[model samples]
Target: MNSDWQIELRALRYFICVAEEKSFTRAAGRLRIAQPALSRQIKKLEEDLRVQLFIRNSRGAELTEAGEILLRRAYLIFNQVQQTHHDVTIHSRHLGGVVSVGMPPTPGEFIAPRLLERSKERYPDIELRFVEGFSGELERKLANNEIGVAVMHDPAPRDDIRISKLLVEHLCLVGRSGTLAKPEYSLAEAGSYPLVMPSRPNFLRILIDGHAERLDIPLNIVTRSDGIGHTKSLVKYGHGFTILTYGAVISEVQQGVLQAVPICNPEILWTLCVAMRTDQGRKRTLAVIEELIQEVVQELVAEGIWK
Candidate 1:
């Protein structure tokens, strides 16, 4: 609200440090500036605002009411400036920089290795970090800017986020090898088998459960798992069957440790999406990474690695 006060950001920063520390000497020490210079900057700041910002004494300086107001506004201003700088820096980066991408455990396990290898081959200077978690967690990380982009599932329609459909992967019933003679199943028939499934709130579980609900069929879920590894382990050992996209169990199925049967009453499909903040939707790095992921997914699908 101090419209007439044309204050330098550096001086505002100095004033904030003094206000927070309540001691000019300590603030100057923290700022690595001479105490006298810090004092002059704060004094100039006060003159610009035409108000007493601090009650100075030998012991310390306490903020006046105006100082408190500036403190609040300055905090907001500095935060915005920092965020702008970060975004601008990211946008300005060329072929070399760090980017974080989030993915669910299943796709992450399959995609991360190929993505890293290809990135090393193509964009060797660009450092890549992959964060693997459930879709719910990945979405939260994307929203908070903890990740630059995410490969996730069922990205609901939202104003602040932009989603691109990368794949509509077919879900199949998986179990210990030789347990099922045929490699195809109706959702109703699949419901008869005991299931090992991720608990509710998991995207896969939600999708599977929704299908069951829609068909008025109850799944005989024998055990619950929050992790893809555990879910695969449970199915491999003949404990029970589980539903997942073919890419998730391709290796196991090929090794004869697990057999997959496509679910076909409605043909369960897992819709994978690449999601990013709408504001940064046009970022070059994001576009490159997204394109690479789509390429990898299509290659897998084409080669029958992911069905």
Candidate 2:
């Protein structure tokens, strides 16, 4: 037996429409084709398979046993072909492929929604997988090819990554609302409260620790956890204060759960970057990263968090 792979999916689709509708006239209407053309495709399909596909009576055409079996198989064949074409087109045109990105949990600071919305409109079939973590973890994933792009603060040294600074802004002071009303507070004052900071080596933790060290002091960490939301929860419960890079703090500040103040005394600023794996580089991945970075920057800027 021989099979032709070159037949247009259009023919199989036309045949299925007629089989389901049971009327050439209705099938043609559904196919946006003349009735005669729809009939011809069905005839051609039956001839190709060397099988009778329909039995016509006064009421309407009904599928013969052969027609039922062929329709089932043809329906599946056409679906598989359509999906294959779709996948190939997306892979080639950057429309329907998958990309993995690492992001921090506090995604709201970046204008992520607008960027994702635009990406979907342009490439409706593209799949974006977001891996949420701090900058260090994200960079590790980028090196492993687990994520195509890492969107976080500028990473520490890693030979496998090539990073581009996308947004630079002062990391801010965040604490439970009403903790302190000062625009800038002394380290002693900032340390007076309990703190729910990330574990040592995490970006925020490192920043806070370095600042305290410079001031001849230390971070007054009440508890250490590994997640932004968990730290936020601690702040919510009045458990402790936490710091946020500008983008991380903006939305929480606006929501009134946390208040943000500018840090002073050897002021710290975080540079948000798009980190790409030198080994896993792909044009599609870069295109998506480029599209998202601007929106993230815009959001941070508009909220005055990244100023």
Candidate 3:
């Protein structure tokens, strides 16, 4: 071990580029450096770390286990350095940048407007960009760094992201006005009705299907519609009943266009979470936006606007 050897950020950047591109030749081209120089840097990095970073093969450079771990840490380091630079340069009172957020249609209906308004009121210089999609889509966007933050429902665990619970919402039985006779329905009873639901792989649909299978209830799914509006319209026009969160149809229920009944006897519940990539450190702007999301959700729940 050489006591004087110290790894530089430049070397890490070169390593990351090679790891991502999976070929030293491509990485050197992208970095605008000669291949031998790039190789020398990586060799020095490996020597400094005292671990095999990559396994060279005819195909390309594949990261070793140690390399994978280092890659994750490298991203965190890079983000932290960038955040530090931003912190020292920007004004302490004002934070500004385009922060992208993602959510499914159901939550977006209630949350987006309030979030935008609150962001504008608090951070006038900050621009809020919203991406509306299903939970799967949102997760993909988060992983790809397309969106900085996402509000997801029952998101599966992922290594690259961190999730914080926002709230737990019970599923409701939704239908045309005066269509449902009961105040609440059990899973079995809910399944007995002609159900209009999104197809398989949808987060909500998967949850319902899992419970139905466990309870041995054969759901009478009459139609499958992926669009939340289309599914709600089908129910509104007397097609069939659909299951969703009350927040999904708050306006419709309030206006007498639709009715939402809670599901009991083992309540169907889903958790809403604020998710961000682990590599995206808590920068000032992102941290502020995250706090605002929590505050907005708390206020909405407190005001009885979101259930």
| lDDT, each prediction | 0.83, 0.70, 0.88
Which of candidates 1 and 3 is the stronger one according to TM-score?
3
lDDT of 2 by residue, 122-158 (tens): 6677666556777787776566555667787757766
Separately for all candidates shown, the number of backbone clashes (residues 3 or more apart, or on different chains) is: 0, 0, 0
lDDT of 1 by residue, 136-208 (tens): 8888767766677799999778888889888898888888989988869999888889999888888888888
* Top-down TM-score ranking: 3, 1, 2
Candidate 1 deviant stretches above 4 angstroms = 1-93
Q: Please write out the lDDT profile of model 3 over residues 161-219, one tens digit for every residue.
A: 99999999999999899988998999889888999999878989999899888888899
lDDT of 1 at 183: 60
Name every residue pair that clashes in candidate 1: none
Clashes of 3: 0
Question: What lDDT, from 0 to 1, does candidate 3 have?
Answer: 0.88
RMSD, model 1, all Cα superposed?
Answer: 10.8
RMSD of 3: 9.2
How close is every model to the real structure, measured as TM-score? 0.70, 0.64, 0.71
